[model samples]
Target: MISNEMAQRINTQINREMYSAYFYLGLSAQAETMNLKGVAAWFLAKHGEELAHALKMYRYLIDQDARVQLSEVAAPASVDGGVLPMFERTLEHERGVTATINEMVDFALSAKDHATNIFLQWFVTEQIEEEATVKDIIGRVRLFGDQGQSLLMIDNELAALAKQIGQGAATAA
Candidate 1:
C-alpha cells in the first residue's frame, strides 16, 4: 500500500503532467498562428504524450487504492520570440520536471517506499529522454539557423518526428 504522503505527491505530479499537456497544447496553437505547421504537429504530439503520462500516474494511484485529486492547470506562459525561444522554454520546463521527479525519488527512498521508488524509475528515465530530445532540437536549431530554408528543413524534420512520436504513443496505447 502506498503511503498517504507519497500518494499526495504523486497526485501533485499528475497535476503537473496535466499542466504540461496544457502547456504543449498552447504551444501547438502558438505554432499554428505562426504558420509553422510542423512545429504545431510536434507540439500536438507532445500534448498527447503528456496526457498519457498523467493517465499513467492516475492509474497507478487508483491501483494503489489511493485517492485521486484533480486540480486546475495554469495556463502556459506566452512566448514573445520565435521558434528558438519556444524550444528554449520547452527545455526549461522539462528541466523543472526532472527536478520534481528527482525530489520524489529521493522522498520515496528515504521513506523506505521501495515500490514507489521503483515505479518512479520509469519517470526518471523518461525525463532523461525528454531533456535530451529538447537539447538536440535546440542544437539543431542553432546549427541550421531558425529562418528561411533552414527553418523549412527543420519543420520537415519535426513533422517526421511528430509522426514517429504519434506512432509510438499509439503502440504504447
Candidate 2:
C-alpha cells in the first residue's frame, strides 16, 4: 500500500497531467481559429496523450488502494500572437513537468519506495523526449516565421507526427 503522502503526491501529478490536456486543448482551439488545421491536429493528439497520462496514474493509484480524488481543471490560456510563443510555452511547461517528476523521484528515493521510483523512470525518459519535441517545433516555427510555404511544410510535418502518435497510441491500446 502506498503511503498517504505518496498517494497525495501522485494525485497532484495526475491533476497536473489533466491540466496539461486542458492546455493543449486550448492550443488546439487557437490553432483552429487561426486556420492552421495541421497544428490543431497536433495539439489534439497531444491533448489525448495527456489524458492518457492522467488515466495511467489514476489507475495506478487505484491499484495501490489509494483514493483517486480528482480536482477541477482550470482553463488554459489562449495564445493570441503566433506559434513561437505557443511552442515556447510548451517547452516551458514540459520543463516544469520534468522538475515535478524529478521531485517525485527524489521523494520516492528518500522514502525507499522502490516501486514508485521504477514507475517514474519511464516518465523521466518521456520528459526528455517531450522537451526535445517541443524544442524542435519551436525551432522549425521560428525558421518559418511569416513564410507561408515553409509554414505549410512544417505544418505537414507536424500533421504526420500527430498521425503517427495517434496510430501508435491506438496500437498500444
Index of the highest-TM-score prediction: 1
Give one digit per residue, the lDDT tens place, for model 2 in 15-53: 999999999999989988878888889999999989888
Candidate 1 residue lDDT tens string, 24-75 = 9999999999999999999999999999999999999999999999988888
Cα RMSD (Å) between model 2 and the true structure?
Answer: 1.0
**Residue 31, candidate 1: how far off, in angstroms?**
0.6
- Worst 10-residue lDDT window for candidate 2 reads 139-148
Candidate 1 collision pairs: none
lDDT measured at residue 94 in model 1 versus the true structure, 0 to 100 = 98
Q: Per-residue error at 111 for model 1, in Å? A: 0.9
Give per-model TM-scores: 0.99, 0.96
Q: Model 1 misses residue 130 by how many Å?
A: 0.5
Q: Each candidate: how many clashes?
A: 0, 0
